[model samples]
Target: MTESTEPVKINKWDGAAAKNAIDDAIREVLTGDLKCKESFALIDGRLFLCALAVGVALYALLWDYLYPFPQSRLVLIICVSSYFVLMGILTLYTTFKEKGIFVVAKEKVGNVTRVWEASSYVKKHDDKYNLVLVLREPSGKTREASINKTFANYIDSNGTIVQNLVASEVTKLYNSLSSEKKEK
Candidate 1:
């Protein structure tokens, strides 16, 4: 008996198709299992309200105490209002900005696959981990996503563990794909 040696079929996706596949995979991981949703509305609402209230209160309470000059009042109002306005603008911008896991780019080098994506968000003041998963096969790609820390929360109120969850999903996908290549 002789063993037959045959070339294994390797599955390859075109650039656009690969991107779509990665996006779909990310969406599945993020939405289906992780239960992650855009928390922009909640974050923006809280920020706007807080900033408005604080600005108004500061202006009202400090108006008469600061100085009697119209110029002084105008300056104070401008200063306070500007801060709130800036905050509102930033919050709105960040909120409306891409609020979900998106596959920004992907490439294949040799036997390795590199995928760049914006996967998570982090607030301005938050000091927590804000890493977006950079999936690389053969682990030599040095690209990174400029993911902003916006608003994202898990439906199960397990927001604190989102990073670990997302990382695990990324790893799972990478491993699955790597195994597929190995099978071929």
Candidate 2:
């Protein structure tokens, strides 16, 4: 229930208990620190909204400067507002259109089941122990995306997301899975 502010003792993370760490933090922890120290503690969509608001306000200031005449001031204000509004809309669309989320798979789903870096829509299933991640491109396009699996450990509906797993973690998982396959 408490977060470890005790400081990260390791510079590198081995994939030993990452799943358990991620799962426990997501369920009970309210805040977390990511690799770059970026806090995803809250998934606030206000970022875009704030940028848009600032842009609009700046455009208003510009409009006032451009129009010394009160009669023309109204027209310029409307035009500048409209232009900034369009630009802001485009900016938000482009940012949200990029792949900002990824899914990691645990097992093979179909013939092509593999966990590569891809965007997705994740939901906590009725069995909170398991999560369902529906992969989709950030373009919000109708085209299909590759499906992958991840156990409950990596996601913290409550914590901020760190850079996906580190390189060492991926290597560890791959090696473990490969060995397990050889055994089977």
Candidate 3:
């Protein structure tokens, strides 16, 4: 009897699909309660811009009265200084917070250096299972890889398998690219 080996299935559009999925995941991560600092920064930034515009307009309208009063200048100074102080406090808080677990890697392909953050999870669909992976950069560039589910005694509950898989792939990618660069 001959052993049968089935050819693997590869999705041509996996990169694009994974990019979209990674974006969704990143959005979910960023909007969670623990990630409020990013949201606060965005809101505060817009507010600062609006305040600047209002201050400019007010200054124009009240140029005559404002020019004579040193206290008005002092108040403006205090407001701007206070905004910076608040942001500093928030930054300190975030610095002290526990960071998220991520598998991070750096690879240089050609002349461009890439930093990748990767994560993986399993999902079920139509009574079947799939392992989904997302690798993305802070700048929104993404790539994806996946594995079709196979029979297992148990899925890893502690995420050790997933993290190891990501780390292995990242290492392989970086080594391959570095070797290629050396060959050239």
- The most accurate candidate by lDDT is 1
Q: Report the Cα lDDT for candidate 1.
A: 0.46
RMSD of 3: 16.2
lDDT of 2 by residue, 21-112 (tens): 44333322212221112233123344555566667677677667776668567756676777677677656654674333323222343443
Off by over 4 Å in 1: 1-71, 98-168, 175-184
Candidate 1 vs 2: which has more lDDT: 1
| Pairwise lDDT winner, candidates 1 and 3 | 1
Local accuracy by lDDT, each model: 0.46, 0.39, 0.40
List clash counts for every candidate, in order.
Answer: 1, 6, 0
Q: Over the stretch 17-134, how does candidate 3's per-residue lDDT look in tens digits? A: 3333333333333223112112233336545655765665565447537565564676556555765665665565434431222233344445664553433343433212243334
Better of 1 and 3 by TM-score: 1
Instruction: Rank candidates, TM-score, best first.
Output: 2, 1, 3
Candidate 2, residue 71: CA error in Å? 3.1
Candidate with top TM-score is 2
Arranged by lDDT, best first: 1, 3, 2
lDDT of 3: 0.40
Worst lDDT 10-window in candidate 1:
1-10
